[model samples]
Target: MSLTIHWTDHLTGIMRRAADPPRLLVACDFDGTLAPIVPTPAEAALLPGMEEVLRSLSTAPGVHLAFVSGRPLEDLKKRVPIAAAGFIGSHGLEMQGHVLDGVPGAAAAWRGRSPFIADAIRRRTEQLPGVFVEEKPLSVAVHYRHACSADAAAVQALLQDTVNGAREFRLQEGHMVTELLPAIGCDKGTALCALADRLGVPRSAVICCGDDLTDETMFTGLPNALSIHIGPGPTAAACRADSPADLLQLLQHVDAARRKNLRKGSCGS
Candidate 1:
């Protein structure tokens, strides 16, 4: 059974944890978490004032911010221009402008396979109306958001058939999008774990917020971390924020609490 808790009920506890560690990792998902999901991915932007909030949090002492997304790294960089924060892109297959650690030769191998799979997908779906193939560095997303019911079904069937016997790639389904990524041992959860490790912080010191099925990995993988799921549905997150607006409110509260604690520490010193 899943229980939904409000951010207010847990704010005090979170603040206490934030003060204890004197360090925190604020990791967030990009689409549907920080920005409202739009029909076109290229046009997505941070919710009003969210960029400013994130910038402030990034600069806060002992607070590190990160954007974890399924987007390609370059695309994510274009959308979120925060130089202080780290980025884990391509569903954790890519990290900090390089293929995630532990996958030494996997990056080169995936690069060779990516174009072949992308081309095969495009060839199979090019004639299907309303189907858009988005090519990433190590993956390809087949977007059916604009397709009618029949076309959408056709797109799905085509994708399933194209990768039926393929061993080099795997499929991931999201809201109106299907992604083909390299068959690897990485995901958002692993990415979060890796991030915490790299920062020399415990999972207890990390806070991760996301709004999709892909985000579930981070929530479950970092059981010790403070996990928040944006918008309702069954989730492993400790709390739920009703919408992006609620998420913003939660961030504002965290920022205020941290700053207050910092000032208090300075006074005592």
Candidate 2:
């Protein structure tokens, strides 16, 4: 069976024609890519077959899988319910297994942060008409999705200023929301690099797929790997698929290619 190769048109066919399917390292972004995007982040769930596919890919020969997300690791574990794969949470600030550190028991660490921040954000945003704030372990997201365009900018400005008092953290800009996180030097890219180094694999063997601006950092860590951008983003990685279904199809193609390479290697041996 043929595999889609639009990505190869721009870059080398390194991942497409591997002799032994070079130790497969697959990293993916969570929202909008693995899980269908929802109105509220809490409402998002994995696409129909994502768990099965992820499980299979993780157990597949020579393959390693990790979920790189801005969500907290504990939240990711609860939401996804997969235990074997590595997880990079809070944009890689709190990681587990091979990809992250500094958060052995993130629940405890998160609790140490000021409760006042959450309370303050909630109370202040409630009075702003259409703004809302969702507190996270490593960050707090001030969502302006429901606000009118006229009010959005004003609410955003107010929230930004409020978070500015959090001198230890920096603001992360996203769609309809702005998040505040620690000023740590880690991101999804850093997470991928840490994993690759721990696994002792060259960057060319990795395959990272994502759908947001934060994901671009992951691609930077894997300069030689196959990078697939699933949806619209400001980064240079072209859109490889339009939806989660398309992403599944693409994974099936890559798996088929790897299986074919394995068969050929066995026969040649």
Candidate 3:
């Protein structure tokens, strides 16, 4: 939708044209994108070398990095270990630019309300074996990974009932998890656009990466940018990476390419 994609070893070809002052915004999802998907949310950590890779990108001249995740902003900041990278959590609700938030998706405005919903969900599902409800400041993820099939199904039904209409909340599904998010229209896609706009970066300079359905919104959101899908699955992303290691390699390519471009510019000057 913004720019065409060409691939060889990585996005090197595209990076080259973004210029020495790339003004690129590199945004990625956390779990299953930068980190291996663990059995539990609390068990998730960055893949080896990811922190360094992200840090390298964060410090690159004219390049901005961000983590646009379903987890709350506070939780993401604790895990990412980078103070420079912008964080958009709660699936685009928290830390999103005011431009997007000012729109109908001002779900960021409803942050404090989710705690009450989370408490009610905990009360309802606590007795169900292996059902865990993870609460965010602005959202709630009900993980049924360890629950029996019947119990998971029942929980799904209950969540569906809770968000049946265009109510205050909506049901968002992920791997073995169902999240209760604000019904606001914003998502990873809108959030990415807002970030780019806020940073004054063009769409052609954007790089979006993620691993699951929720990430599809971003791929669809930045159709012209370089979007990479991790793991084996059908994806709207123009490229595919095998794992977080593969992602690290790709980021390294972009990093090195940008630095090289900067050196070339310096020499020419």
lDDT of 1 by residue, 1-269 (tens): 45869787888897776666777888999999999999888989999989988988877767888899999877888899898878888888777832233332575477666677778778888888888898888888999999888888988887777678777667788888988877777788988898888777789989899999999999999999999999878999998898887899888877776788777783111
Answer with 1 or 3, whichever has the higher TM-score.
Answer: 1
Name the regions of candidate 3 deviating beyond 4 angstroms.
1-21, 96-105, 266-269
Task: Provide the overall lDDT of each model, using Cα atoms, as 2-decimal numbers.
Answer: 0.82, 0.71, 0.79
TM-score winner between candidates 1 and 2? 1
Candidate 1 residue-wise lDDT at 94: 71
Q: lDDT (0-100) at residue 178 of candidate 2?
A: 78
What's the true lDDT of residue 174 in model 1?
82
TM-score quality measure for candidate 1: 0.91
Quick one: how many clashes does candidate 2 have?
0
Q: Against the hidden reference, what TM-scores do the models get?
A: 0.91, 0.85, 0.88
Clashing residue pairs, candidate 3? 1-223, 1-224, 2-224, 3-224
Model 1 pairs in collision:
none
Candidate 1 at residue 51, lDDT?
Answer: 90
Candidate 3 matches the true fold with a TM-score of: 0.88
Q: What is the lDDT of residue 187 in candidate 1?
A: 84
